[model samples]
Target: MSKYWSEAIQSLTPYVPGEQPKGSNIIKLNTNENPFPPSPMVLEAIHQFDTDRLRLYPDPDASALKLSLAEHFNVKANQVFVGNGSDEVLAHTFMAFFRQPQPLLMPDISYSFYDVYCNLYGIEAKHIPLQDNFCIVLDDYAQANGGIIFANPNAPTGRALTLEKIEALLQRNTETVVVVDEAYVDFGAQTAINLVDKYPNLLVIQTLSKSRSLAGMRVGFAIGSAELIEGLERVKNSFNSYPLDMLAQATAIAAIKDNDYFVETTQQIITMREWTNQQLQSLGFKIIPSKTNFVFASHRYIEAAELMGFLRTNQILVRHFSRPGINNHLRITIGTEAEMQAMIDCLKRHPDIISL
Candidate 1:
């Protein structure tokens, strides 16, 4: 460690993102990225952008992008807040709402970034364990907490909570803020955006990266009551006046306007996810019932780490978490039909997998 490093910097166990392979021929499935290209409308928006304005800074507030998002979600302009990515919005959220006297409550096996953020901000966190089947138990969250946040169609596990369960939590736990990270909501999950108007404390965060296929554009937004949005804005402007760039703003607008394409692509993912689940089950892998674009599964006999290594050798990349209780499971992203078949074929040829 460098002597100049501050105590806080030295202590932080930074979040480790999924590996991005250097080769082009690799079937990259570790990160939950959309298999299809972005909408044609989004491409046209980029082509038509006025490049001469590169010298000028983009809209600091991202007003137009916010307007498009508001229209898409049926909310007003002030109710939306845009950022560089959902991760950035999540960072601002931790600073604005999660830092408090009471401990922040979240699932034990959740998006690892939540724990990283809590440690980064010096917030106390209480982890509620998921049920044996890797399902988040909501009743565990009702006791007391400074704040609560979880991914809808949750990451890694890909299990989701319904609107009814979310509202029930809201009805009783009204004292503190509640954040629903809906990064994969478009894939076979209901949104909590409608409940935002009824529950002032609820905030819904979403990204164009998943369904709209704009991960490269780096656009994410939060929908909440005007007051909560204002709070996020205060934190954002204090840290960085402009988080979204000019191109990002334009890309997000076009992606939002093309609702038909978004629907078609997400439906395709949902369909593929179920198909992959069946394929994996046929090979004796116990798969979780996933509503997201990825499926989490563990083989009945083969070790996940060994399988991951074998797949990596075959130029196929899938995510395997070594965390306690889930060390044997692999989180595989749903790719195109051809890519999925290639993966299945590769697995079928595995010597050990073939024996089973």
Candidate 2:
């Protein structure tokens, strides 16, 4: 609105994050965050970290953290790239490999941030629509483009594409980079990290926020060929040399090392998601087959916006997008058992909304 603003700033429509209400009684399922606490080892690491280290800059390379991720994922150290979060890593990826001659290809109903990054970097984008069941149709992506990126268990819909399909896309399109955003892969979907070694153009992005329960710490990384890793590093260093601070690096390293804790927590969320799906189905909601930490569902009779408002009035918050093709559905994050039971109780209280 101001003449002082740059052209890019003036034309930008920023991404809207889920609401973080300030209260203890509210059942918050709007944001897809882990409902469990971080591993005990992560807490121990945080306690052991020396506050005096704040005086010095963290290792510019984040060498220790990268090595941990490499060992955990069975990738070489040179093939790993760390950043402030997956969002920042993705931003650097757009600037590095996606700004090519052809427009970038992505799902029409994937993460909203993809479009935001495109606008910010002036990268033209070609949106490929998902199938009727909300699953990605790989055949639609067999075309010329600068690059390709989509969530494995796609956002809002919680539908996952098979690894065979992903590999087939990579096999057919070897010319452009393919970025698979696996932010929720730990929940149930198979990771594409294993194929990174086979395909030089494959880049798999992940975050510790969801399954690892470190959303507050803000840590994310990318695994790919050394060439792609180097490209991301160049963009990262040019933007900010110390993207990962001392505490964040330490916390993330600890989280990665505690494999058992990570598995237990993620498995619990997966189980809860299935139970929640069945419960919603019993109440006449058509729940999508979800492999992530959330479920996408729509009532047979009630409107999504109306149900969203009803839940909010009862101190239960879930996500509802006004976008086309999905405006009738609501995305509900899997909370603790008690919280979910409370939500069910709330639904029971409003029997009028549910079909017999």
* Candidate of highest lDDT: 2
Candidate 2, residues 1-356, lDDT tens digits: the string is 88999978999999999999988889999999899999999999999988998999999999999999999999999999999989999999999999999999999998999999999999999999988889899899999899999999899899998999999999999999999999999989999999999999999999999999999999999999999999998898789999999999999999999999999999999999989998999887999999999999999888989889889999999999999999999999999999888887787677565436
**Inter-residue clash pairs, candidate 1:** none
Error of 2 at 205 (Å): 0.4
lDDT of 1 by residue, 1-356 (tens): 77899878888999999998787999988999999999999899999999999899888998889888888888999999999899999999999999999999999998999999999999999999999998888899987799999888778899988999999999988889999999998898899999999999999999988888998989888999998999999999999998898999998899999989988999999999989999999998999889888999999999999889988999999999999899999999999999899888988988988887
lDDT of each: 0.92, 0.93
Candidate 1 vs. true structure, TM-score: 0.99
- Candidate 1, superposed: residue stretches over 4 Å from native: none
- Model 2 lDDT-worst window of ten: 347-356
Q: Report the Cα RMSD per candidate.
A: 0.8, 0.9
- Local distance difference test, candidate 1: 0.92
User: Candidate 2 clash total?
Assistant: 0
